[model samples]
Target: MRTVPGRLRPRSLRTRLVLIATVLATAAVLVCQATGLTLMRSWLVGQVDDRLTDFRPPEPVYRDIADGTAPAHRPPPHETLPSDFRVYFYDADGRLLPASLGSGRGEPHLAEDITARDPADGRPATVPARDGGGSWRVVADSGPDGMRAVVALPLDSVEEATSKLLWFSLAIGAFAAGGVMLLGGAAVRLGLRPLTRVEHTARSITSGRLEQNVAGTSPDTEVGRLGIAFNTMLDQLRAALHRKDRTERRLRRFMADAGHELRTPLTSLQGFAELLLDDPDMSPARRREAHELIAQNADRMSRLVDSLFLLAKLGDAPTTEHGPVDLLSLAADGIAASAARHPDRRIALAPLGAGYGADPAELDVVEASGDPHQLAQVLANLLDNACTHTPPGTRLQVRVGSLRAGPRTGGTDRPGRTSTGPPLPAGTPAQVIEVADDGPGLTPEEAQQVFDRFYRVPPAPDALRDSGSGLGLAIASTIAEAHGGRLELDTAPGAGCTFRLLLPASGGT
Candidate 1:
């Protein structure tokens, strides 16, 4: 186990695998040893039983020369008996015969359950010798006429052999099992070596080293595939962390910017109110002017606060008020309204198509799905931005078309119309609305940051700077994005900028 700052871990993979292998090997060895010992003991017992059942008496004991009865069958010689076997003889009246009759045992040693007429039938019976010797297996058989005989063998030899076999088997099995355990442990350790490398890499990652990765193994192996997956997950985690950090930094900057914007208006209002309050003899016109000024700044502060809150809400959830909105009509109305707001600007509407559309008043109907209010607000922002930035009498046009081609490239096509880029995928037409003006177009740097929140271009040396909150384009961009669309700027220095609003066409339009 390796120590991490606050984490206590378990045994390494190699150690766990070795322990598992050892347990398995021990189980296999035990099973084999138990089976072998059982079979060996049974075979040895059968051998001893065979010897007891096959024993035969000597020939003289079968003869009737010294007895009153004649022998029915002659038995084998004494020397033919097994070495550990002993025989017993009984007379016709069931009297014990002396050892001189060539019986091996000193006297009769049959158990009480066995009798002359009942001849044992070769079933083993434990017998105690009359001379008080060790246990014996005894069997009885009828001899010639009324004579009877019993055979007995001691148990010590059979027991000793079986015991020796058990010990030998145990000794061999123990040695074999030990050797197997050693080999199995080594094999397990070798097989899991790749996992060890992965563990080390994981440890490094846990300790804040996100860039570490396991490498150099074939992907075909299980461990190798795991390593690849682990590395991919690590990359995703690092990316997420980086994104979170960046978002936190942006939030801090946004807070500071918002405070500065609000503070300006509040200070202006406070200064004006304080002057009116301190001067008891202030003129009626002066008081009226101060009140107007305070009201103006107050309105500006309220707009900034509302925009900030809207931005925050947009980040959390999109507007749910949605329907099929005629984008062309919306842009037409926005242009007409801007014409009223800035009566000096020459604002007009047009239609773009493959034929270089002939009519501006009869523009093609282009529909998109979105909250109509939000969409209208987006249009207003674009028209207002153009009016405020451009010189008085600068000609501005709002072109509406079903874009077979997607968003426009940053170049002027005609006095009021700006051209678009290449065509979109077949059968999925998008709607494009371009707001173009002949005002001095933005520089490359300005174009890049125009959509960023609270960003405005530095004013030119001798030109009047427009009073703006700088969140107009940012809000429009956010709203467009929320509706699965985008707002793009196509501008370069000295070439008037075209802001293209691209939205997916609604169903049936």
Candidate 2:
């Protein structure tokens, strides 16, 4: 496609609008002027023709011309023609008679062929004057003795009046066109001011000023709506950039933490293998101990790698195998496993509130729809996290029940916490599993990052050597989200930590 040259095409919207408006206005003015001029000329000529029709020469003048006795180049007695009118007579044989009458002004020389034309039945005709004075409007009629009488009126006055009006209309039209151009240009500029501001804002954003926004975003006009959409787009873009930045930061931290965790076990393995290899003559018992240490370190490294892989998988796509799972049963199994692992710790299944049965078997069943294996893993991680963090004697309880009311749905006062997952409406059915421990609780600052991957609270001096990896709660939180649920922590300084896993209930059991 061929494009118009920049100079020939209007570059700005304001200029185009002004140009179009001025053109239309000028065209309308020209049409009206032309119509007025034509009507004025027709009306003026009609008046002259009416005058010629109404006038009648004196009877004695016509009688003298018919008898061939009228004086040449002289007016007769009792002549009453207007000063602007001219009268002439023609013989019956179509020959010009010298006799004529006129005002004292110079006479117009009419053509002989025009004078000899047949009678006009009182209708007027326009003919050029041979004397070059101007044109004339003439009417011819038959006299009593078959002589032709012609009355001529000069058209200079009509032509002069119409010429003056034409010039006046042109002057007024030019003034009107200029006024329209100036006023229309200003109005168009005013109307497009918002667009100009939007363009400026877009440029600012392109230059990395994400905070810039278009002003005047009312929903009333086209420009206003455009500004509103532009602002909305900018806000979304800024948010996306922030999210991307956060993702990158988290990935870097994860990589650093993983490397640090792996390096510890790798150093231990390398040290023990060198010990066994260097001391070939050492006692058999020492060699066995060194080999066991090497195996343990190797196992630890394997677990860390597996946890990292699981996190990556969950992050990439959280899809899970869906199935019906009873949260109460899963909680029972998790408590049993934790008790077996730490025989000294008192881990037990308990009711969430006083409305439930006393017998564990008779407790209200809390059911949910999700991957049964994944849901079980979530329960196990929550229980393990509780058992590992608290002291051996600290009492830990697993509670399963259906939520009666929705939890709060806004950002917490705690710095590290985000908005409590999307609000579950009041009275909406949901399954909940909670792992509560009466141990040294976390502070607001600690609680914020407790769920972060590889984040672990500093262990007590008497804590066990196998404190386990810090990915349990983070993995549990991810699994809960994959199941269309959320993991929440309720704790404060000196208050026991309680991890709650809330999932939409499949149906009442």
In candidate 2, what residue range of length 10 has the lowest lDDT sum? Answer: 410-419
lDDT of 2 by residue, 345-425 (tens): 787787665223455554687677888887788888877777777776877878877665443421122332332355455
* TM-scores, all models, native as reference: 0.74, 0.70
**Residue 338 lDDT in candidate 1:** 77
lDDT, each prediction: 0.71, 0.77
Q: lDDT tens string, model 1, 166-237?
A: 777677667766776688778877877888898999898889888888876668999889888988888899
Please identify model 1 stretches exceeding 4 Å from their true place. 1-13, 46-79, 82-110, 114-165, 180-192, 202-210, 217-222, 346-365, 399-432, 458-465, 504-509
Best by TM-score: 1
Best-performing candidate as measured by lDDT: 2
The TM-score measured for candidate 2 stands at 0.70
After superposition of all CA atoms, the RMSD between model 1 and the true structure is 6.7
